[model samples]
Target: MSNKSEALSRRFEAAFMPNYGVPPVALARGEGSRVWDVDGAEYLDLIGGIAVSSLGHAHPALVEAVSRQVATLAHTSNLFLHEPEVLLAERLIGLLGAPARVFLTSSGTEANEAALKLAIKYGKANGRPYVVAAENGFHGRSLGALSLTGKASIRDQFGPFPADVRFVPYGDADALKNAVTAECAAVFLEPTQGEAGVVPPPDGYLRAVREICDTTGALLVTDEIQSAIGRTGHWFAHQHDGVLPDVLTLAKGLGGGLPIGACVGFGDAGTLFAKGDHGSTFGGNPVSAAAALAVLDTIESQGLLEHVKTVGTLLAEGIASVEHPLLKGVRGRGLWLAVVLTAERAARFQTAAQHAGFLVNAVQPDAVRLAPPLVITAEQVTSFVTALPALLDEASHD
Candidate 1:
């Protein structure tokens, strides 16, 4: 690490909480799919801020929209209405291809919190007190969302979560069917388990879950925080199975890099919350809304959905073709991928990749996640693939 970066890390440790520990590199600036460290060392940004930087860094459209909006009307609290917020909501609903109501939040945790409240309200109204979620699935870290998160490692530390929440094994249709009884208010699922090393469910898992929800009159809620907004070559990952959820929560890439989240409720689920039920102060701040609008507009204008599919396939195929003993396979779809290692060397692999001027996440001990910007090109992917063998060799030695 550079001296400047080391100084910054020391300052960060002293000044801030250690919730995220210390980031390995202190980035100075970013452009497109690359970022520079404080020492002016450039690295290919494959993680893309944990799948939050949809358009990569310093995108022109995002910059102009945010700048213009902040200069004109930066923030108008929920006390009043704004054009950007309304337009963003409309655009989201239109893209969803269904009749839905949108509740905007500042982050994915807030969005899931809102969804939790909606589920609670639905439970109260319908006398269904149970909520089913998949084991090892991640929603968020806030208390409400945390309650819905089925990961024992995180949830065990936070005790006495909301009651009547059942967790079934992920990608198991039979388990979900058995757990989601008629008394279940909602079933929260991630179309692709992002935090679980981008583990995608079985081919007909989502469709079967939808059917089970229909049979039991339970509201299906899909959390697409890390899998939506063209990240998975679709507007929403649930759409891949041609299934629609009654409620969908999104964030991560919604505002490209700005903080924004949405809790969209469909059909009768849309009207569950009446006046004065739930609210947010900076939910739809004009600047963030404008940025999100720009992201949506650019995705459509540039045909980035198709671009993501083509480039993602190339990257995945290239990684799979690498003749490495440590490499097991690749998982997930589109730009959201996880390189499965044969052993618990993902941490070493991440360090090796960083030393080689590439950034990837050790999402699990045996999985290295790559969620590059949706705008990443084939050439950039090719570069990474070409360098993978040596990076793996270094990891093996370490």
Candidate 2:
């Protein structure tokens, strides 16, 4: 059998309940911004594994930290305190520039789940129980998190959701001001809405929401899952406007490709979870925490935040110059970019981009999101931009 087919056969047999479709390419290894398939065909990875590979493949710092910690001590559950977990917490709070409490988990969904529960508990404490979120804002897929997600397709099959959640237009501060009453305990936002096609809010929109929440005494929860941890040229995406969320949900890039997530709570929200209020068995494990610390240290030491902004600007300008009828414009900040195409051409463009030895994603029918690793260079972005006109032409015919 061919090596690729043989590998796929084995994976299909061993795996359980496929959620992501059948495999496309079997990745062998990766370094920097490149990945090679099992057949040894290499491609420039612009999607960055759906924006998870912040430092790209096998970054030396991540390798060293994870290796040392795993060899020394791997999994020590929440039964006791561990150095890696404590150290990571301190670093995260310091970067946020606020007194924050952290609840670590294994993935972004878990972090969102924990955050949703905290909002619920906080609501009960304040004698208010409703939560407010925005249309087209995606939080996560878990039952609790899905309840807050504004996408209808994602939440359609799973009905009978918790009763107290409401949705309004994203970036509509006035709508939020009208929707959130005294009965609402919290409002969740993604500074740049990643999954619903890299939609950045209107200028000063986040600041306005913060003001509205303050006036209403409601917590402002920011889901930084797709835009946080240097993906958007900042420690946190919302920090661009100098706004602090009552609670922040983070993952994707936090562990440098390893599975780790955290819900950071600031001020009074920080102390909401008392002893026995919430816990995760495998949360804050030493190995994952070690990986996160390395990601943070590397970002600071390498000045990757600056690099992201520089390269991302080039990408946006390059995409804008593509000169295709389907190409509308580019949105988002830093490495988190989305190209708006005409009609439902995102899928076609994704296929075309892949065939051209590059990778990106169709976040929606008309928008394609490109969130490459922060490590991607200007030269690589130029190469992708150079190929865009032809790629769009081909995708249009397809």
lDDT of the candidates, in the order given:
0.94, 0.90
Over the stretch 1-398, how does candidate 1's per-residue lDDT look in tens digits? 77899999999999999898999999989999999999999999999999999999999999999999999998889999999999999999999989999999999999999998999899988999989998989999888999989889889898788756899999999999889887999999999998889999999999999999999999999999999999999999998999999999999999999999999999999999999999999999999999999999999999999999999999999999998999999988999999999999999999999999999999999999999999898999999999999988998984
> In model 2, which residue pairs have backbone atoms overlapping below 3 Å?
none
Per-prediction CA RMSD (Å): 0.7, 1.5
Worst 10 residues of 1 by lDDT: 156-165
State TM-scores per candidate: 0.99, 0.97
Best candidate (score: lDDT): 1
lDDT (tens digit, per residue) of candidate 2 on 345-377: 988898888778888898899999999999999
